[model samples]
Target chain A: MDLVERIRSGNKRTLSKLITEVEYDTETGREALRELYKYTGNAHVVGITGSPGVGKSTLVARIVKELRKREISVGVVAVDPSSPFTGGAILGDRIRMQELACDPEVFIRSVSSSAGTVGRTTKNIIRVLDAAGKDVIVIETIGAGQVDLDVLNVADTKVIVLMPESGDEIQMIKAGLLEIGDVYVINKADLENAARTKSQLSLAIKERDGWIPEIVMTIATSGEGVEKLVDAIFAHKKHLEDSSNLRKGRLEAVKSEVVEILVEKLKMRFYEKFSNARYSDIFEQVLDKELDPFTAAELIEKEEGL
Target chain B: MKKGKNIRVLIAKPGLDGHDRGAKVLARACRDAGMEVIYTGIRQSPEQIVETALQEDVDVIGLSILSGAHMSIIPRILELLNESGIGDIPVIVGGIIPPDDVEELKRRGVKAIFGPGSSVNEIVEFIKSIT
Candidate 1:
């Protein structure tokens, strides 16, 4: 409760703890979110993503630092998904942004997509944090050079980062990177083929339709050319809002999320009850093809009414 | 003797290295041991791993780090759990741990380190002993 209150009052420690608890979906976490939900919607959510080696972490840290310089309070959410058999997180991108955790005006949260759903639960809890009162939110998805397009679905503004010459237009097309970028950043600007990479991305962008996403060139590690990237983020966020289509999309998404949460809860409860109950005889009867999945579902729903 | 309740385990793989064959296999083994095992799909963060272990009310946070970044990642997760008051969760380490770092993780409060070639029965037995 103290953490919830303090987070609402913009306390970094409280916000950090609350983010962890809520991301974990603890009872207190849910309650804290419920209390703070009304305070969300104030923070702008900016999602930073791209292929694995595009230096998304370094890029995100730079962006957060830049935003902080503007006196804007920011919350960072980073997702890491490297294998741990070696006994460590492979990406460790969150560590790049770890310094911001100590800042009172900045709250940073790292989520492993492994522990969370395609970020739906993470987003819910984070939206709760934002409502509790942060000025901006940035989410870094796990992995590099994604083909899944999962992060684009999660972000208010999608910044797809690419390392110049990391790959060609064909590679970007193969990874489906061409479609997800609301803003394309050719990072590693200090590299040898920065210009060539930009041209290839330009070709990729031209080949795509609709919004004609902007492409920015950056050298994220040294903080070179990141301000333009942040400006592009804000602009894109504004563009999405001004379009008014975003509101409708958001409403639909919220409704879908609520439906999904309830369905999952009921499904889990049904599974638990079915697994533990003395309905084995009935199940066996059905197993003989006497009852179908629909009837079974109906019976379970009728019996539980949850 | 078996502990007060089932030994809960959270099996997680964090970061971009998405080879999950080992993680899935280990998850199944832990469950077969009669431990309540929660498998966080693939590519998790130290924070997500720590948070899930807390909420799942798990007894052991078994991390399977295949990527080479284990040195930097495992310590941060331990720190987060400690910060959250559940530092006593009796963390376990698994997957390609270099033999040299095995003792180091244990010293950092990791109770056990199970790597490639480790047996499920042995892991179960180890968990039983700890619990």
Candidate 2:
């Protein structure tokens, strides 16, 4: 059967297998994506990111619950960092976002960034999940300062989750996080200085160059102000729909993702085709000043031509 | 796509949840199915899961959790995985959980759930039936 029909039919195994092929970037993988790409563009992309201890996970759980209550189909991509030494990443998302795992409408996946940067990992997976009939796809990025920009590249609405106890609001501007937020969430709002943090964020948002981003205060634990937060996001999504410019921004983001994916696939194909002991020996000879990269490429091409 | 050798399973723990005994058990089950298993240490963020899965290019990401924080962490991991671009990783959940919450998890995005006292053989067979 054709790939598009299977995807539209909601065959879980077929969806799973197609994603695997694309993950490997094989010949069929490209074909599968080409076939599946037309079926995309349906799911709303939501980005959830913050510092290490800001309770971002808890907030995500709340968001998922809220979305599910509306009977909206959801897809989630939980991004985790990797071990530098072993090149391994520990993936554990189900423990926290357990409520929706068994739901027929939701498709949750965990990705380890231990293999590559957020720039590389975020692009293709969005397509994979989007094609799987999700009404919404949530992207939870590794919140380490500026690398957070990677999330902005993919999310239709970027929600920057934050805390007051984390530090002065000026630090976020310094880190450049202030400019990227469509929604500024001051989570842990039940804390002692939660209100103060909200004002601080308000001040920071006021100073921003573009439209004044909306800031919502929430205690993610007790579910305080979560509805407003959700409403704020929906409002912003509607605003995007109303404004042609925001839609343009979304298209630009998709175009950029395509470039990134192509570059990554090209690099991977080259390494997979030429990265071996034989290629290493050629490199070693080049290291001795016997041959340059240009000469090595020539020789490798010549060998392949034979 | 074979009975075993073609698949590699990664059972990971994202976030600050340190309970890994259940994760270890699932890892063992995947291994027993003749699939290669990669286990990461505890307290993994969602980004780590996406990067590792892409690098290793595994078939499954089995998350083990005992902490009652499943709501937040699972969605976080799912969002990031979608962002990273590899989707063949059919995620399965195993650990401490209540009954009603199971349906909610399915609605949010988990492909399968392995509760306490579930047979390892049941897991193996379920996996076989999927891919």
lDDT winner = 2
DockQ of 1: 0.05
Lowest lDDT 10-residue stretch of candidate 2 chain A: A82-91
Tens digits of per-residue lDDT for model 2, B7-93: 557777766778778777766666555555657657766766665565445777778787788888888888877775665468888
All DockQ scores: 0.05, 0.07
- Candidate 2 regions exceeding 4 Å error are A145-147, A206-210, A261-306, B1-131
| Candidate 2 lDDT score at position A158 | 84
Error of 1 at A199 (Å): 2.4
Off by over 4 Å in 1: A1-4, A82-91, A116-118, A144-152, A206-210, A276-306, B1-131
**What CAPRI class is candidate 1?**
incorrect
lDDT of each: 0.70, 0.72
Give TM per candidate: 0.64, 0.65
Q: State the local distance difference test value for candidate 1.
A: 0.70
For candidate 2, lDDT tens digit of each residue in A1-306?
Answer: 777787777665566566556655556777877877887887888898888768777788788888888888887877766544443444554457655545567766665554345554465667877887888888888788445677556888889898877777557457367767889999887778878877777776652324467899988888787888888888777777777646688678778767967887777876887666668888898899998989998998798783
